[model samples]
Target chain A: MATSRGGAIGPALVLHLAVLAIVVVSEIIGLIRVPIGIGAVILLPILYAFALGIIFNPNVLKATGRVLNHDATKLAGTMITIAIMPFIARFGTTVGPQIEKIIAAGPALILQELGNLGTILIAFPVAVFLLRMGREAIGASYSIDREPNLALIADKYGLNSPEGAGAMGVYATGTLIGTFVFALMPPLVHGLGIFDVRALAMSCGVGSGSMLAACTGGLVAAVPDQKDLILALAAASNILTYATGLYAGLFLALPLTEWLYRTCAPADRASTMH
Target chain B: MNNEIAISDAPAEGRAIDLASHAVQLLVVCAVALVGNWVATNVSPLEALPGMACLYAMTIVGLVIAKYMPFYLPSVAWISLVAIIATIPGVPGAAFVNEAVGKLNFLAMATPALAYAGLALTKNEFAIARKSGWKIVIVAICVMFGTYIGSVVIADLVLRITG
Candidate 1:
């Protein structure tokens, strides 16, 4: 059933077409245009997908399970993987011409963007002390924003490890809400007028490229004069997140999380910990 | 020998037909994407075509490179790198490429991809989180919370230095 024969399409093909139709419908309904089209907006493509998926879910495991189990979805996941860079690349070109301006503004803006790592500091303690989550969950909950984090965790703790499940949970959560939440930060900060627009713009690049773009887009619309430099700083910071985030998270962030889990986890429960 | 060989070739012949159909299916998906873009932005389909072409073409090229890479370079990085090089200001077609591709919304493409992901999700997908109980949700919230706090602190510090 997974494969097609005699020039006929299969379930996978139907699934793809059905999904695309939903996308077209969502666009027509303007679900993506919520909260104004300015700085840090919520596009909600993932939300849309989840909603439609549940609605269309046949509830029959065999037929519906086919969509979940096929090799085609894996291929589609590959398609989405390739989609990330070009998505960022589009933003990259927009900022490429403005690199010199951002450089002249101040290199310190790059450091400001490192705040993305702050998640580990806070998430680890909260997960270990407040929530009493296991060590694996601590690493996962800290930074499950990207693919490499999943790989790193899985490599150290087998895919079936508690850490893997924890990673998957957080990854799903991040995929669902991380972009929207992160997208709102710049404008909110800008509205507070607590920081210079440049710092706010630079901070927008907390490593997730799309989130960076969304944050920067909001800032650009909010303060149009700073567009080029803001975008440039964000692009630079985001690229750095991809380049350095893996090692930083694995070496620096997760270790801190692990240490917190060890220190904060109660003595009775600590002995059982990984 | 001829009848036996013909019988053996049926599945292979069917596979070839399936492959061709699969390609058509991809093309149809692309068409839906373009049409959807036009409806959402009111950008003419003609204007959006070039950008869509570049996006898919580069993805194909990126896939090819990914197939050969010795290490684990993501396909997006490769596609993005090529797109960036192509659109640099001094390049011959930079302006055209930027304008054309810029017209197509990457978010639009993401819609279908996410929707497909949704269809694949059954209630069972949440079983792990359920077993983990409320702790997973707490971790998710804490992750976002910490990231926000971190962003604010970093932004504040950077502003202080620059100002």
Candidate 2:
């Protein structure tokens, strides 16, 4: 029922500009705050867009439906693919001088970077035993979600299948809120000042380029003194996550998650019977 | 000179014109996005316009280089690698562009883009998640929680040992 209109660039641009305007106005009215500098202001736009979409849906301004559909919304996402590298590259410039710091941080930095996998470790068991999900659900829910893993799952299980639905569920959640989580969490954690800033920085590097940028941006803005080091650590850790993540997700994360699911969860027939 | 020839030629001509128009539209969109990025950052238009242009130009050049690489490398990776390499002090033109563009607030640029993503949410996607039931939310929450805890433990331990 909510399928997109596909290539309507004109309507897409108009809707995007409208949402952008709302965000700017909201920021001016002091309805929103960006203590972590200009980067953390992303939440405003999402809020604006979500609100606008809901108000303008079929229940409200029915004529505005075309502007709020999947196609119009996706235009910005496709544009994001373009913006991501430049953001990271600009971030990369700062890393040049921080090489020595990165080397000094060494293995500890790597371990902190490994924190990105914490979700997989925890989710695998929860998905299997607690949720009673099958291998497909466990695999889809366990890793850093992006296109490649989704494709792998789709290849093994048809897009219409239950596995596909599982991937879709997580993918939807990740797409919708992942950036917000990354942007807000670090600064909140850092503001409390419980952990080392470097550890916070390394923790920001959870693979996805956009999230890395968001997390690192908030961390940098929050702890401006360690800006270079934070960004450097984030950039390096992001690269490792991206480089190793696919192999790990498919071969290591998914298989292991599936194994845990089968071993721990009651059989599918049993769960259904319950 | 026949009707058939004119009809076939008209379709071919229309296709070419359509393609050229699409390309122009794309470039215009790129410019608009740059402007949006600049405005969102609260930078003065005078200072930011040229800086945004330069930054975008460099990214385009980086994309071109990535396209020509023998092996398959995503443009984002190549762009970052290229931009980083160019930022070295002695490299001509790199330092200037890096200085100007690097100052542009990344979060500001990302904001509208993400807002666009929010706007993109369709009822269909929502329906699918809903149909899958509350379990999907549970899975999503657990995944997010797991990530947070994992990061905290590893980060704290590493810092303690290293610091």
Candidate 3:
């Protein structure tokens, strides 16, 4: 059961426009401060992460509607996360590089496998767990059979059904894993004498874009319900994590994590759709 | 009964544009920008602060324009114009172009990787065999090895070419 299509288009257009405006304005402001630029990039995925939490959560829009209590808590948790992330990143960088040099057999092939595992273990799970806890604390709920109206919209666009949403979730998980792994590259590269901040930023952007595109595509195909909202929120978080990882991996962690997932586990991908 | 249930479940068909929502979004963007700028100042010593007055003016004007027009095209057009006017020869548009390209590149890489992963998950291929955790670990180790070797190969190629 869908409403007449007339009203939906305008609101969707407005939301899209709003997103564009935010990106444009933030990028412009970013030009003045390099850290701001880094922040802008990092913020995208963080925002996307939160949006995914909302989209997947059965009670999100309703919770978001109750701005005073539920929504406020979620927002507060997000802000707290954001506030501490930079410090965490700083610490990670300081500790990572020194450990890299000591453990590596030689300075040249300094990509430490353990570093990658640590990133996967530390970053993705922490971010996802925080998001899930925040959403739950904010009273967001989910169930196997209770599909919201937004899911219908997603279905109409040929996205994942409720049964298929897990596929996209896995993709998000993978991206997070990949991002943490790539985080070590900046330091590893620098240890080899390629320590240019701008260049590092560019490389990070490439890695982030790749992850975002992969995640977006999967979500669009399998979990289109509130894809726009999810993307917007997740993008914000992604930007922050990427920036922190960049600073941490390059400056602090020398022979950073050397993990990569070139091909997906066939069983995990297949089991995702209903 | 069915009709009523369907009708009630849906959000209002045509509630007027939520100006409040738009306003909230704008406020969030501005707040994030301000905080981000403050953080950047502490982190990057070489950065030049964009004039707050100019930034506010630009953002407000941008918001106003967005109300009546499409968001991305106009904003990009305006930002590009500002950048062009601000650019000086030999200064290089590296920052602007690099930032833009970097965003584009992230999206590009993310799509395929996510798709593959999604497909794998859906197919139930993402399993570690019993007593085979070590095998999975080995694969992960190999991935690390591959990335390092790959980077080294590329770096060597670049150095040779440059020399």
Share of native interface contacts recovered by each model: 0.43, 0.42, 0.01
What DockQ results do all the predictions give, each relative to the true complex? 0.25, 0.26, 0.06
How high is the TM-score of chain A in each model? 0.74, 0.74, 0.25
Off by over 4 Å in 1: A1-8, A31-46, A57-79, A82-86, A102-109, A183-190, A196-235, A270-274, B1-30, B64-71, B122-124, B148-152, B159-163
Question: In candidate 1, what are the lDDT values of residues A218-248, reduced to their tens digit?
Answer: 5665676876667666665665566666777
The TM-score between candidate 3 and the true structure equals 0.31
Worst 10 residues of 2 chain A by lDDT: A37-46
| Residues A1-274 of candidate 3: C-alpha lDDT, one tens digit per residue | 1222222444333332333333333333322211322121122232332234334222334442332232222232222212222212111211122232222212221222113223333332232233222111100111100112223223332223322232123222332244434333333443455432212222221123333333333333222354333233223223333323333333332222111111211222222111
- What lDDT score is found at residue A152 in candidate 3? 28
Off by over 4 Å in 3: A1-68, A73-157, A161-167, A174-183, A192-201, A207-274, B1-24, B32-50, B56-163
What docking class should model 1 receive? acceptable
Ranked by lDDT from best down, the candidates are 2, 1, 3
* DockQ, cand. 2: 0.26
Cα deviation of A112, candidate 2, in Å = 4.4
Q: After the best TM-score superposition of candidate 1, give how far the Cα of residue B38 lies from its true spot, in angstroms.
A: 0.5
The alpha-carbon lDDT assigned to residue B162 of candidate 1 equals: 63
Ranking by DockQ: 2, 1, 3
